[model samples]
Target chain A: MAVYTQVSAEALAGLLSGYDLGDALSFKGIAEGVQNSNYLLETSRGRFILTLYEHLVDHAALPWFLALTTHFADAGLPVPRPVRDRQGEALQTLLGRPAAIIEFVSGVSVSTPTPAQAQAAGAALGRLHGSAPGFGKARENDLGQPHWPAMAARCLEGAAAIDPQLPALIEAGLRATRDWPAGLPTTEVHTDLFPDNVLMLGDTVTGLIDFYFAATDLVAYDYAVTHAAWCFSADGRDHDPALASALAAGHAGTRGLSADEIAALPQLGVGAALRFTLTRTHDWLNTPADALVTRKDPMAFARRLAWYLKATPNMVLGR
Target chain B: MAVYTQVSAEALAGLLSGYDLGDALSFKGIAEGVQNSNYLLETSRGRFILTLYEHLVDHAALPWFLALTTHFADAGLPVPRPVRDRQGEALQTLLGRPAAIIEFVSGVSVSTPTPAQAQAAGAALGRLHGSAPGFGKARENDLGQPHWPAMAARCLEGAAAIDPQLPALIEAGLRATRDWPAGLPTTEVHTDLFPDNVLMLGDTVTGLIDFYFAATDLVAYDYAVTHAAWCFSADGRDHDPALASALAAGHAGTRGLSADEIAALPQLGVGAALRFTLTRTHDWLNTPADALVTRKDPMAFARRLAWYLKATPNMVLGR
Candidate 1:
């Protein structure tokens, strides 16, 4: 939501000299991709997003992210394919930071998506999962169940300041995820497929963006993350049954879920909730008071975890 | 730059329904304006910038700003004209904020401007001053000479924290402007014409933007402000004689300065430097450490003021 780096016109021209994109016509710093500085770059050729990777991005995993998005694009997903320069390089250095240009995908990201949009987003995620087998890359889900205990401990140290109920809710969330299952299904999952990551046009998923959090993880866990993200109210206090049922049906229609995967939905949902809770709690506690970014409330996910602790598989998957 | 407000897709759609620009093909939060939320909005008609007025702006004076830009556009300057709705309204409320769409002007703002570009910028400023007499509107220059003493007093309180010498330098700058010349040429001037405000392609100036500070003021004061903005090194430690001479020659080439405006160059230059020094000092001492905006060094303009305090009219105006 902020441009951390200022790109000069001379530096931009130097960067564009390597590409076939004609003389730069217009360039603007865009407030997107929190971890990187993005510019809406328009050249004689076409519109593209010029991204300068910031410190938060893992430089070693840069190729993997590009390859994953390229794989998705090849499979006909509306992903922004990294544009290669004349020397066939997608990544290079500009202003002492790794930079790349990607095709600009046009679509609106709805904040409060309608049920039809939610179904379309689910279908898009299912397609993403369906296409993962063709790509020959895998990364561990660092935020998965095995890491939750330490994350919970770090958050618990200062969780009292954010909310007095946070420590107890986190402990309860940890207890609920004790039976975290494995081996049901595996795929490269977009672990952060909130509604904002999915672009929509009239209930159709036109683009699935922000693959920075993609990693090899449980299919049910990925589904659980999406369910938790989409089926809840903004405050995360209440669930929308209509949206949940439509989303589940949409995902199931694209790829059939086995009985084991379906049965594990409730526990995976709890784990998903706890994962976000711990991370948000940590962010809320650590983020500087004057940071331009608005810190998302950890209690939102804490409430989601509370709901998932008592929710049955039918309530989760809407079976 | 940062986006202070997030406009949802629904709200954007609702906004577009008022105009005939057709559905929004794409909308992105742009890091352009410091005082407002600007979005690069694309539709079937053309590209435009949708600006949502924020707290720093005076709501009552918005129509005046819009009308002034419209007046500039009408006078053939490369200013973005406000787009009107079916009912001929450019200013409206979106998400409880005043918002409007302006025509998108194309060109890049150079950080290290060439001497030729500096001359062109001066010519653009000259054209702006030349075009002003035709327009029938006047607003007090809120950031002009009259406002500096109070601004300097406020900045002096905490100037030591920034630099020990700043307070003395501010006092000296105040003394230099104590006999500030009056009864000079006056017009509607863009009081803040930094390099970023003037967009260019090669030596040709295509756009003169950011008129938030435009008000009726001495024509020489405006020139002095621009001269201070463009003819100095990034650190303000050194001046570019070629750039200074070219900028003055260019402006004079377009609109000849009187002997009084020419002789007042040194004093007005000192005043301009002091004005920016005070503002930047106030911002530096007051801006929260966690604020996303980088607080510009007030010392940069302090150094400029120091130079102007000793510089002769020939050194400043390149006689």
Candidate 2:
């Protein structure tokens, strides 16, 4: 439910003059992506999504994001293909903001995805990981372990204002995962694969969106993030073992995991939980009360971290 | 941009079970109407608008609004025909709010409508006025002249906080229109026909939407509202005489206005200005700072009223 910027019809007409997509028949701001203002645009050519990148996304990293999706789409992966203007550029400026028109993918994003949907999402993610390695660009994960200490410290500073127990809980979680195993396999990972980002038609995954968070990170950690996302209830405390097993199996079928990767799943899962917890805590504290975007509750991830603290590798691996 | 209630997938699926419109392929909340939650719903059937009525609309008035559109649509008027469910009811409950699935009308709404578009809108509005007399159900205009005094008082009470000159200006408007002309011809009127509500494909008017403000009022008053809307600049201060003349010509071409109606146009235009000014003033002052809906600038209508206070019938009618 976000449309931070309002685009006028006259401005849209001026922008469309550079594109070959014909005149816009209908243009509407849609509540889709959280990081950008998205509009469901219908032109004489077809239906397309016009996105104006918001402040949360760095302009320098946009080319990488566009290229990554273009790479996936060119490889016949289920992703939104960026539509280029007559000048052969996918990105342009509209209303003083970087904007792009991407092909509209038809599928409903499920909030409470079933086990079958979880499996399909896992398989799609594994395929993405395999395909993305061929792309030559490398982006260091900006929200990874190295940045966690600073984020955690910021969260601790505002902890007492948000909740009395937040600081101690975050400190304990940080201490537990400070010595995570190193030298794991690295690849391009969609650090955010929450159910909202994956589009599904019944049991099939039709599209994967919001690649703005894609970065070079541990492959198993991507699976860990997905597991944390899909295999938990809304409360974040209750884990669904069936969904987790199915997701893991789906990933194995596409891109099999190594024994070391399996062994490190629990620690990476804890790390994944902390990464989200810290970012969400920072957002929860920083976002203005009058902002259009609703901040996710950080406690949900904290609850997941609490569960991971007591769980063994067998719990996530279903050994 | 309003999607006050977030509809979950499970709830959407439940709602669709009662309709023949196959599973939802894509559902995106649209930033269109301010008073309701609108989603551009694409199902296996086709495109439709799924609207959940907000608290601002009275629940009892739902049927009258639906039936009125249904009547006009059946008569081949350019309106969004309501799609009835399996029970043959257009209005139903979804996400604990009065919801309806309306046929999606193609074409884009213009912010700054061209003179030709203004003419087309005038002609279409005339047709609607002619066709709506047989709608059987009659709803009194809730924001009519009788309600103006209380609204004026409310605005005056809060005027100093908004602006120093507001109270004096409003008091003058209230005193000037206190004894408005009586015995005007009344009929079903679309009171809120702003440029954004009328869809146009090139120069043709494709659809007129957001009939939630429709009621039985002076037929000339509806035209007055349209004149103020279509003839004003974005700043709501400057009036385009050519556009106003064209709009008047277009309306007269369809259903010629009576001599009395033409004579009352200026006073009605002033009333139209006051009606909107009061409502916008109320919303501007009352809407919470954290509310998702942006309060429109009341000063726009204030400026319009100031213009109307000085204009003669010859200026509006081009006699």
Q: What is the C-alpha RMSD of each candidate to the true structure, in Å?
A: 1.7, 1.4
TM-scores of the candidates are: 0.97, 0.98
Residue-by-residue lDDT tens digits, candidate 2, A1-319: 5887888778888988999989989888887777899999999999999999988898899988898899999978899999999999999898889999999998888999888888898889888878878987899989987788888987789976776766776887788778877888888889999998998889988889988989998999899999999998887869989888889878887885788998888888888988988998899989889888888888888888878888787799654
Residues forming the 10-long window of minimal summed lDDT in candidate 1 chain A: A285-294
- DockQ of each candidate, alpha-carbon based: 0.72, 0.77
> In CAPRI terms, where does candidate 1 land?
medium
Residues B163-234, candidate 1, lDDT per residue (tens digit)?
A: 899999999999999887988989899989999998887788888888888888999999999999999997
lDDT (0 to 1) per candidate: 0.89, 0.86
Question: lDDT (0-100) at residue B123 of candidate 2?
Answer: 94
Query: i-RMS, every candidate?
Result: 1.4, 1.2
User: What local lDDT does model 2 show for residue A296?
Assistant: 86
Clashing pairs in 1: none
Which candidate number maximizes DockQ? 2
Which is the leading candidate under lDDT? 1
What docking class should model 2 receive?
medium
Candidate 1 local lDDT, residue B54: 88
Model 1 spans > 4 angstroms off? none
